[model samples]
Target: MTTAPLASNSSPASVAEMEQSLEQLKVANYYLRVALDQVTDGVVIVESEPSDPKCGPKVLFSNAAAAMLAGADPETGLRGLGLNDLVAGDKDATTLQASLQQAVQNGGCHECECALQSLRTQAPIPCKWRVRAVFNSLRKLLNFTILISPAQPNAPAKADPKPAVEDLDAQSVQLRKENLAALAQGIAHDVNNLLGPVTVRLSALIQQVQEHPALAHELQAVFAGLKRAKQFTSQVVTASKAVPRKHEPTDLSALMRDTVEFAGAGSNVHVCVRQDDNLRLALADPVKLSQVLQNLVMNGIQAMPRGGYMDVEAHNHMVGGTGDGRLKPGPHVLLVVRDRGCGIARENLGRLFRESFTTKADGNGIGLTTCKRFIDEMGGEIRVTSTPNVGTEFRVYLPAAEGSGSTKPLSPADAAPVPLKHGKGKVLIVDDEDDLRKVANMILTRCGYEVVQCDNGQDAVKIYQSLFRTGTPPDVVLMDLTLRGGMNGTETAAEILHLDPEARIVCTSGSVTQEVQMVFLERGFVGVLPKPYEAGELTQTVHRVATMMKRN
Candidate 1:
């Protein structure tokens, strides 16, 4: 009944048939690869060993098109590249990974849209991605097949093309803004590091030159310029990160000057800024206020493309009564941006601040709307007055800061510099910037503090650990969020806390996002010191943090 086990099929005919089947399989695999390479859509194969799912999926193979799409060399393909390496942001990468895992378990094709990081330019390219799970005959998971294609925007119906044009125009402008934001974020860290030392040094120089009035005045001007540069960088980061708005006493005169100068730079437009001798500080978000001013000034410049004069004026005003519904009764800082250009039509004046309402042929009409929204959020008012072919004017009224806090327009004679706070404590400074460390050391040393400096996080941890072992841990550890290599500031802080949980660490970074600061605080950091800080601020922060630690 055993059937003789198929008569032991090792004969010459059987061997020949087996060789033929093996040859056919080789031919089929070669053809499949060629077909994948010839397709327009990108094809990538991802696989993970069943025994080691924790290792996740590795890029097993990619066709020519896939290589091109992923910004890899066609000959080399994208094999062995980490999954996260293909996605642009951390959030997006996590989402894609989750989707892949779901597809593996649920047995269906999963789709998502995400920006892919291009290896050649290191730019983000938006794409539509799909993942399908592959399984063996036993239903055990084997691998995944991924298809990538460029993302296409949904268009409006063909009846009315105006909406489509407006949509495209808006998309174009948004794309440009995103690109600029990315560029700004990329350079902000380096720029802040470069400016931090100069800022601290300038503060010290001004104090040193106070004996000579004229010399101090000259130094004050340089310091003012440095502040403007820092403010610009901060505004860029604020916009890109979309941090929460903060209202504080703002020097509107300085913002006006900076915006007018920036908007008119290299342009034929003539811009003049005027401020009252006793202009009061405004209670507003300095970053958003700067943005609003920039938008208005830029609009004025564009209005007069053939070269014309624009006036930007800031003054203190008192509203005794709430006569109109537009503004509340209070002290206000009145800002005027006037342009001698082709004005809007009388009928369109009311719609100036309306969303997506544009008078220009190519305008998407979001600038004025955003300005209005931001002004309103700050308890302010914005009004527009225009006459066709005559001129146009934009008026912004911001709530004046409490008290008699009038800001003088960059007058060194009226500006009395704040003295640096003296402190006695040991501080461990971790930063990669050499000049910055030198300046920090100089400032802290003069203020009666012992300072130890290190370039990277590895050394930083080691120094702190040794200090702790010797029973003389630094009273305050100033940790920079970004380091050139090895562990970052957060990771270093974690390691230090692991060694000594009661360590008082302060997070210093160019990024001032509320979310980022909160994360650091929750991770056992006691304080935060933003970069590009003056000597006074640095000394004050260190003193306060050290004093608190001693109290604890």
Candidate 2:
């Protein structure tokens, strides 16, 4: 009787404890639901039917975040929905389905891009979500869940307020371009000035080389080499450096053919150009056009690693005519480069022409931008169209010859052909830099001309006066504009002109701007040469100017 009473009394106490444990469990479930609804990240729960490996997938539940992602109400969401509604159908859906199935079979899943790739591709990819598997104690898959949080794209790329380094880099690039352009022009100008007197003396010396035939032949070869070097410099100035050149008549087909050839050098891919002979003609700086074509074709070839075809075509065009090309009424030449390779992405097309934007891993990002600058300078335009896995096409339009690019004279053809110091004439080189003046003196002496040097305008004037006192002024005077003592090239030229009205003065300076070059020309200087000149250029300009003086 005592043992039975003890058992009966223990039953009610144990039952009360069990009821309290159930209430605690109920309270925990309620809090979990509250946390789910308030969470920032989307929470998706997809369970496997019958906990079987081969069972079809089913949505067990979804949190507020998940419903928001699916374009459903956050508060009263997950009533009924299909995964297909969220994931783009076809390939994307298949990939998602397979991933869900795998996660359920494995009892748990880990974060993977394939988990959210469907949403990333379709939705603007505002956030990146990672999927994980929830499993029971028996190691059986219960549900596959994913957490979604705002991704990098949603962070606003331009919102980095403290991007001092990037801002500096961008500024540096812009400054570099401006500095390069200015420096290049300055160098060209200075080169011309240095060569002015040297070229004049060389021409006169070449006339005297009639004495030693063998020596003259050797000197002629030197002159030829000098000429070639000048051409090379011209190419460099036009290519890497920014300087304007007189445009000349150019055949579009010929330009395209040469560009294709240039890009093909040492490359495995064969470049084929199909340009219409009847295509629009234009007055273009052949050198600049050459640079543009080469850059584009090279880019096309680089896009294809396995070697694909690059079709370059040219045709006459005018605005208002449809792209299909039955030309209606505009004035342009159409050059098209069609490539079969990995095409540019839709998102990337706008950035293609932006300076410093590069798709290539190793690219410096100047090729396309340079092309754009060249085309814009030529009064033309460019357009691009690309399809992923299909191909890319770049179309360039240049104004017709009659409309914009008309051929100019070939005065620059005789750019650097004369030998300095060889011509039989009196030459004067005036500059502030003694080393440069001596260099000019040596070059002119070797060319067989008597060369005198002056460091300033006052000295230059005295020399001319003394020469005139002896009844024979120099055949040519290479004058530096800024003599560093308030006496500029302009004033010096004026003083020399007063001494010898027929003075052949080639004013020189690299620092002289375009306006100053014009000033010197207007001041009656026979030629305007710049400093930083090559030996051949010096000799050539000297000869050309002296010959003109003699003719006059």
Candidate 3:
């Protein structure tokens, strides 16, 4: 060792070898950095002084994922931060410190679930932290390595083993539900388009048959059937809608009476309704609540094959002491529907609200489920009690409208219906369905409007622009939302608005979802009209929008 002293300067070959080694090390370091960055788990190295454990640890290094987890710029990294800075609260920091101390003492790895706060977002994120203590050759604590991963919210500490088949089945069921919802949405649109022509043609026929009383009566009956079909289509459309219901102060007593009368019509079942004298209004979506009650009443009517009586009663209830656990403490409108019919079996009671769980031979199995869904969305609860061969009772609890009192019920004269008015103006109808376009044309023409029809959004836009340039822009534009082989209604409406900000465009769609309606309105549409609408609705909507345009 003494004879072989280090050379002050190396030869050319030796220098080249040294440079090659250095380059290889640099290459290895680059690969290591790349590998660390590729890891999904957050990796961080924190240095701590073994002599002063109370001083806590300082972050020495963090990979890209770790930096992201801390809500710091990933490219810059979170190297100069302290361990306590990343914790959510004082308690979290204390817990983390204890875990680090334990790992240091045991010279082993430790793990704990923590709620860490991101510096940028300042939001507490649940994470599973795996910490290992590092020691120097002298057995002195040096630093700690941490691996952090996002923890499943409220997951069990010890996960139980699940069969692979069970997981696959659950996934399959979820996928099937999603697919069915999408299919239902598409079918509802197509059905509404198909029904539009039928409804318009029926209206035309009814007008023609007015002179012949017998034919008029027959056509009226056919029209009633079509109305019922329209109701069914509305339910299908609502099933796929996930938006929040637009709640309003609704008269529960009036709604119950109307539903009972409508559901028990033509059936042998008789419906009786009793309303509380001082009943308060309920905060509910009138249309959805009406649908729920109608479904329940119809189910009650169907339960009784022979002649039977159904009683519907409504009252205001105060829920606080000894109240329902499912609902919060508040005043609620309680509606009870009691039917003397063949009651539900004990086994079927548990699954009455489950989708596709029906005992009827011809039942589509979605009626009760849809009803339950609507009730839930409206922040209400529905419960059923039944006794075999005796009867069944359904109780619905809806939150009462805030600040509502025992006010007098609205009279027929309170809100007079606006009579359908005939208007003289150019109207444009856009729809991919030929039948729908023809139906709209017929309705608009009958309303004394100069009707222009196009089968796609592109043609409609072109026609609108051409008319606009000629200073003969349509008074109203009815744009169908979903289109085939061209720009959709939203896109077309945007273009039309750009060309003429004063354009009065009404969005037409078979999807009667709040989200769809709101989106169109946000995109500058003046109004929204659901498909398969009556001639009166079509006339009224156009007249209303045209009037608005004139006033503006």
Candidate 4:
């Protein structure tokens, strides 16, 4: 006897188990909703034949926000709608139906925005609609499911979930957007910090070439490598996208001064900033904010490659323009960085904020884009005005403290350089770069110190041991943080300290993460000697280490 397909259902046992997993499914649902709202582009979800109402997408679960775009209230349910019915371009509903059938047959459903619209059209659409296929985990179409999104999906801003779960689906997407925004900001900060020292070293190398024209050809090659490195750094600055971070009340003017000084090294460019000592503070992360300032300052330096003055200014301003015919004057602080150098043309100004858009021959163009992202995350805004040859200025607006005073006095200045004479003492140089090791060796030897060079940590350790055994141990060791093959600078330093508790080992590298630098300090390294060291910086460092050694 032929039996009618008993209305097709997932068996009772499977249904019961799915019912048991509702809690887990609900959590997953929240995340999907979040992605729907927070992503840059759009997302459309269509669910049909849901076995469990709590765990699966229901016709009623379709977000009203989506329908609102189509000029319909989602509170009223939609029924008997097929994928082809939603769009006018579906000339042959058979093709769409066949694809849907295949999706169900495959045990997974899938379709992209293009493939779903490849079918024949039966009617002219009164409404312009963009059709995209919604897919299941296994690349199958959940039969009878239809989701209609505008040309682009616009995720809504998220609201707090704790106070109200009913409003969660409405705002789950917005919170996701915020999270991604913060991530982008962090990435930008890290990338800029990494590039800072490389730029500084390039500057120092150029000065060296100018000082001694005898080594011009050799130094030219080195400069070429450094130039490539700079280009590599610029690319990193380009692709870096970061999410904004949580902002707290901070002294914007003071922070800008500190950031610029630290990154500028006050050597390549003249940095200046001014503000009211008692002006209101801004809510921003000091580290991230510093990274922002550093990137801007770096850009300013590049614009004025011959070296020129750059100014950073910050102050408080009142903002008004609240709806409901009411004016709400709020405390907002403005920070400006201006450089009198080769400026951007009017045409380039409009496209400056776009990703990978740059005017410099070596620029990757991510700096301004990252800056804009960060500013937006902090609940602020950034603007720029530039002339072709005169100069360029960047202005950032940040929310300020409603009721406030000021932070403490200025931070201490950089320590004065200690004077030293070329002395006849044993100096050990450890580095991963062979060229650097040889160059350092030559510099130290010229300065009248007996020098021993090691290209890696293991080699340095072996040489140090051989010397100790031979009773001719070096007086001081310059340890590089990152080394080629075997132990790193820190490990080598630790081994040397094992032999002599008062080993005068100076940790060296052009750039190190602040956290990694701190590790050296905690582990008792005498001092840090950052890389791209000038011939003089190396001499001074050795003299200081020797003096400290004798005293200890």
Candidate 5:
């Protein structure tokens, strides 16, 4: 009866259905292989022999990632490889085997960090592994599914030589200084952006009121105050840098007289400058050196609130012969600021240049520190001598230029404004800042030029292409270096140049570093107009570029 029942169960339709089911399983397996290959981490499976579960474990399957990790052909997989082939040494293999056995006994999951040797490279690769064991209903060991990921290499142990407390303290202090300097730099960048419009508009106003004598005088005074404020912001920026800006030979005596007059303008302190006509020019950043002199003179003036005279003297010195160890062995220009006022105490003299350490009730203490930093950056030295109830003197020794003469310092006289050349073509302005664009539009439109504006580089490029195609290419394009949510100024400039080889593009940015400026120039920019540019600067830069384009 059992034989007859078995024979009746196999119809043609049922056999066809069984065949279809087997085909579906094969398709599923193919899809699974595709999915596993797409993963980035390695996946592998190993099967253990039923009779010798502890010793004979062989690779049954491996995905493409796993094969690549093992340095094998992905199509061939890592099948038929023993556990010993993957692990670095006999000890590692034994450890892996034990871990597998433990996982099988305790519900089939284990994780470990191990070194696996690459078959092709023959180098040990550190890896983290998570292994899961599959089991039958009878609790027999079957196979292991492993996920392998590259692990960070362990740092080597060092000999136990305890570091000194003083070394640790110094490290901490240095780190703190670095962090503070970084913060100060970020603040300075933002402040510069905010001050840009004010500085430019103030210059514009001052230029406009020149016909009104009284009004011009008042605006000039305000402009001077703003200039001083701008200097302070620049000082903040310099405090964050390890080195000063580029140095050129500058007349130390002329700079000293200007700083003394500026510092003692409203104070009762009568400042007098004394220097020889043959004083050699000092190699320094003119602006930074001026700021240092101003700081010293201001300190001197503040020390004498009861109206006293301060002397500023400049002279030549042979460094080693000046009786100052801080000055190197070379020719130097010595500038001294002497004030007859209550001098610094002996105990506080050593800490005078330390930031945030001051004796005055109203002092923030960064003045002397900043002066010291600036002097050091110029490859110079600053020293002080003080006697209680007598006077305090600050001396700065800067390296003297080798040559007898120097280039005249940049001044308004040197940068005499170029007359606006009225143009017949359209001007395009691309910037993300709305206020800045508006300011630019006002200036360009007032100068008898048609102005177009865009807030991003992509739109600017599109507009430029459209204009070029229509046979009305812009006479000049003012581009901002950075734009949010689109292509940057450099990319846009390149695109525009592709559209029109003779396009005149001037790059602008508030935070334009020297490197960025160089990149802009290399990318076919006609000129670079730094942000917060005055109306005259913008017009002058545009006019120059446009005139060049016309000539070309």
Candidate 6:
């Protein structure tokens, strides 16, 4: 018998076309492999050698999903892996082998269920398998394609209805914390607005009562009290909003005095601060450190239901290499707070700084944790010592400012107050609060400047436009962020700038976050003045802006 040569009559041009077609098939196969690798379902092709009984089916090719399901390295994939390696037990392996054989014999797909064992974990995961035989046109077997998928659980045991206890508690704590932060922010805003007018009016009163020493002293005390209240509100905003800290050379002596006074304002605790004459300055964030100090002081006050004395002392010290592992050895400022109150129990001392651990019935257990976090961030350490029913002492060590010597410096309050700036320029004060507008008007008028007032954004726009029409627009405009109607401060500023491109507008708000300040500044505002500001700060900012406008 003679066999006819294949393609004996084929032309050269046909051979070229066939080569191009083969290249296209290769490109198509590459894309198909890429697509399969992207899918989540595991695809594994196993080659069977029925002619050789010793060589069973082995993995011909596998995608990423298959390698992951088998817990094998992606680089090695599942190539050369035997069928038995993928199955968990002998029974499952036998069943899979039978399904493959049936698929080959019938030339149809076969389905079965088995568990795939992970090579790394050696753990069995229940999965469904679909076997399809691949063959050439002549019916010559190529490979068996298997699709592996996670098995669907029986209806009676599908899922666990109850969540884990730890997960539920964590979620509850997080929700409560978020709610508390929101509440604190709201309260701080309202309190700042309420305190704004009082702070301004008290400054004016203090200036007016300078002729009477007795009255002046009393008014000064009240003014100091108001200042402390404002600081407390700032601390509230800082704690709740998680404001980024701005570190500077801080006067620790002054901060301790102010914090102790503010924390013991309404309580029966008497806080006495003793400081070294030559205490060094601390390189720290003033607001955050003040918050920490206030928390400790308040905790001390709360510990003593009855009236008692607490001592706060500050001095400079040098840390050595053998101290606590966390702190770096360097010049340090040590602040010690001691209180004679119902002390903490000995058994609970180790967990004093642990998160969500508290002894008080009404405590949320975040105060000490926050305090420790703040101190740690400032490159400091805070330690506690307590004896049951005796007393408790907290020692805080802060890194000293670079190049700061032992010469005593004045605190912010102890420093001489700058004289209120006197300038002659037309000013417009716009605010929704009646008392705020009135206080600003009085203060500016006393400083020898003509002042105009408006309650809402609409009137503010009208007044500014009218002034501009008359060729005598106000030199500076203080725009309140929150207005009763029409437009807010930002919108009003935009309208004013539309009428006059060179409008000198200042943004004022009780809640002037960093984002808010940046937004207003980008919109061409000249300055930002946070609410509850001192009279000196208000006059200084306004005078500076008005003068700059004239200079231009």
The top-ranked prediction according to TM-score is: 6
Candidate achieving higher TM-score, 2 or 5? 5
- TM-score for model 1? 0.58
Q: Taking the tens digit of each residue's C-alpha lDDT, what string does model 3 give over 1-552?
A: 358765878788988898789667856765777788788888988886533344357787787677656655433367767777788887888888888878877776888888767664434676889999988898887789999886644433356545544554554554345446556766887888888888767766676666898877666666655665676677676655433446889887666655665677799988988888879999988777878888888888888999878898888888996668677788999989899999999999999999889899998789989888888877889999999999999999999999886747745322222234688888999887887688778777877999998887667878999999998999999988776543567778888999999999998877765555675688799899887876767888998888774723
Those runs of model 4 whose alpha carbons end farther than 4 Å from true positions after fitting are 1-333, 336-368, 376-380, 383-394, 399-424, 446-448, 549-552
- Candidate achieving higher lDDT, 2 or 5: 5
lDDT-better candidate, 2 vs 6: 6
Cα lDDT tens digits for candidate 1, 1-552: 456554565899988888789667856765787788788888888874423343346787787677766555343468777667778888888888888888877875799888777664555767788989888998887788889876766677788768867765754554455445555664786688888998988888788887898988767766766776777677666655545557899898777765666657788988888888878899998877887998998898888879989999988988878534566788888999999999988888888889999977999999999999999999899998988787899999988988855676564443334569998999999988888988899999999999999998878888999999999999999988877645568778989999999899998888665546776788899999888888988898899888884623
What TM-score does structure 6 among the candidates reach?
Answer: 0.64
TM-score versus the correct structure, for each prediction? 0.58, 0.48, 0.59, 0.40, 0.63, 0.64
Collision count of model 3: 0
For model 4, residues 366-461, the per-residue Cα lDDT tens digits are 988988887776777888999888999998877776576575566432111122247677988887576667777776787789998878776787
| Ten contiguous residues with the weakest lDDT in model 2 | 114-123
Q: State the displacement of the C-alpha of residue 262, model 6, in Å, after optimal TM-score superposition.
A: 2.9
Clash pairs, candidate 3, are none
Q: 1-552, model 5: which lDDT tens digit per residue?
A: 345443466989988888789667856765787788788788888885533444347887787677666655333457768766788887778777777877787799988877777664445666787888888898876789889876643443365324444444544454345446555655765676676667666666776766898886666556565555656666565545443467778787657755665678889989888886678889887778888888889888878889899899988877665456666677788899999998999999999999899898988999889889888988899999999888999999898998754435435332222234455558899988787788778767877789999998778988999988888889899998666543567768889998888999998865454534675677799888865566778787877777784723
lDDT of 2 by residue, 1-552 (tens): 355443555688788987788667756755776678688677766654534333334455677556544444222345334444454445545666666666666655644332222221233223444667677888776666767654432232566745655554554554344335434544554465454455444444555675998876555445443343344345544433333566666777655654575566667666777755456576577667777777888887888888868888877666875643332356777889888878999999999889899978998899899888877877677789999877799998776777443323323223333333346788998888666787778876876778888887767888999998887888889987656543456678888898788888997765443433675677888887654566666777777776674723
Per-residue lDDT of 256 in model 1? 77
Instruction: Tell me how far candidate 3 lies from the true structure as C-alpha RMSD in angstroms.
Output: 17.2
In order of TM-score, best first, we have 6, 5, 3, 1, 2, 4
Identify the superior model by lDDT, candidate 3 or candidate 5: 3
Would you give me the overall lDDT of model 1? 0.79
- At residue 390, candidate 3 shows an lDDT of 96
Q: What TM-score does candidate 5 reach?
A: 0.63
Determine the C-alpha RMSD for candidate 2 after optimal superposition of all C-alphas. 31.5
TM-score of 3: 0.59
The stretch of ten residues in a row with the least summed lDDT in candidate 6 is 410-419
